[model samples]
Each structure stands twice: as structure tokens, then as C-alpha cells.
Target: MSRIGKHPVPVPQGVQVQLAGQTLTAKGPKGELKLTIVEDLDVTLADGKITVKPRQVTRRARSMWGMQRTLVNNLVKGVKDGYSEELEINGVGLRAAMQGKNLQLNMGFSHEVIYPIPAGIEIKVEKPTSIKISGADKQLVGKVAADIRSVKPPEPYKGKGIKYASETILRKEGKKK
Candidate 1:
């Protein structure tokens, strides 16, 4: 009864899917992604679509079935449409900037933090407070944004932290005098 697993994945043009033994390899214009097939979780390719049907829904299978299908779908879409994440810095004097492909961050530290951008991904800092990340791989783009935000996770007090632009943070007030 998993909504995600029940959904069918459409086979897009220029993308190749190969089911070899217990492994699935998806190749697209962007890149190739591979995953090991879980036992008893059947994936069938029919009529330009992929379907998932688990023989028995155990606790493990129930939890993983939906995730696996979602990952596969993302891979297919990533190769075609790509992905992006935006980050914002909130604080006085705490900002982020791009020095070429490296990110320069000033987050309450005496020295500026430098983060190098990975290949196949592009980072653009609109200002000291806004950063945009774009890449063909959805997972890669999300992971990079997470790593950058982890550098200065939003503080509960004063809400000074690096967070996704669309994220909302709970602000904690200062202690009473």
C-alpha cells in the first residue's frame, strides 16, 4: 500500500535502463547510476515504464521499497531536468560569497571558511547572504547544499545560521536580563 512504490516510472528518451541479475543500471545523458536490487522486491520493465511489486512486505521492505523507487525516479528525472538548491545566511556580518568555484564564508569565525565546489555542480552566490547550487544529479546537488549549510547551521538564538532559502528556522530569544 505504498503510494511511492505503486507509482510507475516513465522511461524517458535517451535514457537506458538495464536490469542485470540483482543490479539495476540507469544511464542517461547526465550520467549513470546503479543500485542493487533488494531480494523479493520485483522490478519489471514493461511498455516504457518500470513497476515495483514486493512479494512480501516485511518491515525492512516496507521502509525501503518506497525509497528505492523514489531514488530511481529521481535518477531518471535528474538526467533530463536536473536539480537545484538555494541557501541563505542570516546574521549580522555573517555572510557567504563565492571566490571562483570556492565558497568564502564568514560565520562567527576569525578566519573565513573556504569550501571547494565539486565537479558537475555549479554554485553561484548572489550576495553575501544568498547562494544557489545547480547540478544534473539530484542527490549530489542536495548533498552539497547540506554540507554547506552544516558549516553554519542556524543557531536557535538570534537565528544566525546557514540554511536553505526556503527553510524556516525557529528563533530563540536571548536570556532575560
Candidate 2:
């Protein structure tokens, strides 16, 4: 038995959830999101709660039980409160700015890196060195943050690069003279 699958996902106020065949759609103040459940699982919404159960006693069905339940929970929370990711530039000249609908990054390269912002995602540069990315989709927000960080990942020696606001760098000692 899956521990997480047994618990039902509660529908918060101001959020509407609808189940149609294999697709589950959630709409709230933030936005609306949809998820397609696997055929091996059964999903139901009742009494302001969503429940997930396996249709058969199979290995794959059992393995996906908890994951599908968590996915449903994420959908509910995402539509209600949304998600966000923060990045910080550590280098001296490194900075970020919003150019029209794209993110312009200056990370010590010869040319500025232009990252086109996707639809439904918002990127803000309150400060030159700090970036805040927000959206209703948690996976997309995280993916965009990671993609931006990959452009200039922090180095171990100087730790000069883009990193998550909550991340820690493990600095390395310089060579002896």
C-alpha cells in the first residue's frame, strides 16, 4: 500500500477542479492547469476531495499510485498559490534584465545571452543581480530557472556565476604558491 496515495487532496476555497475521463483540470485565481492520469489508475473527486487508487494489482500501477496522488496535490496547490524560483548573480559584471518579453543576461560572455520568456511565465529583475521567476506551473518555473542557471553555473573556486537564492556553493582552496 502506498502511504501518500491513501490521503485525499483537499480542494481549497476559490479553486475549481473537474475530472473528465483521464484528464483532470484545476482552475483558480492564479491559473488553470490540466493533467492526464494514467490508465492504470482511477481518480475521483468527491466532497471537496480528490482520491487516487490503482485499477489493478500490478507493479507499474502500484508504483504510480503515490506519484499520481502527489501530482494531483501539486495541481491543486499550483492553481491556488502558484510557484516561483529565485536566482542570484554572483559575478561582478554579471547581471540580468528584462528586455521586452525576453530575459537579457550579461554573464561575462562576449555577447549578452537572450533568453526568450515562454508564455504563462513571468520573469522579473528587481535588482541587477537578482532574478525572480514565477508562474502557475511548478515544473515550468523550475525548468526555466535551471535553464537560466545552466548558462553560467557557479564555479567551485570563485563561486562566480548564477545560483539559486537558497543554494550554497562549496568553495575550493586555491593552489599553493
Model 1: CA > 4 A from native? 55-59
- Residue 157 of model 1, lDDT score: 77
Tell me how far candidate 2 lies from the true structure as C-alpha RMSD in angstroms.
Answer: 0.6
Return the TM-score for each candidate structure.
0.81, 0.99
Look at candidate 2 and tell me the lDDT of residue 126: 98
Q: Across residues 106-140, which tens digit of lDDT does each residue of candidate 1 receive?
A: 99898999999998898988887999998877888
Q: Best candidate, TM-score-wise?
A: 2
Clashes of 2: 0
| Segments of candidate 2 deviating more than 4 angstroms | none
Error of 2 at 9 (Å): 0.4
User: What local lDDT score does residue 167 receive in model 1, on the 0 to 100 scale?
Assistant: 89
Worst 10 residues of 2 by lDDT: 91-100
User: For model 1, what is the error of residue 66's alpha carbon versus the real structure, in angstroms, after optimal superposition?
Assistant: 2.0
User: What lDDT does model 1 reach?
Assistant: 0.85
Clashing pairs in 1: none
> What is candidate 2's lDDT per residue for 46-165, written digit by digit as tens?
999999999998999999999999999988999999999999999889999999999999999999999999988989999999999999888899999999999999999999999999
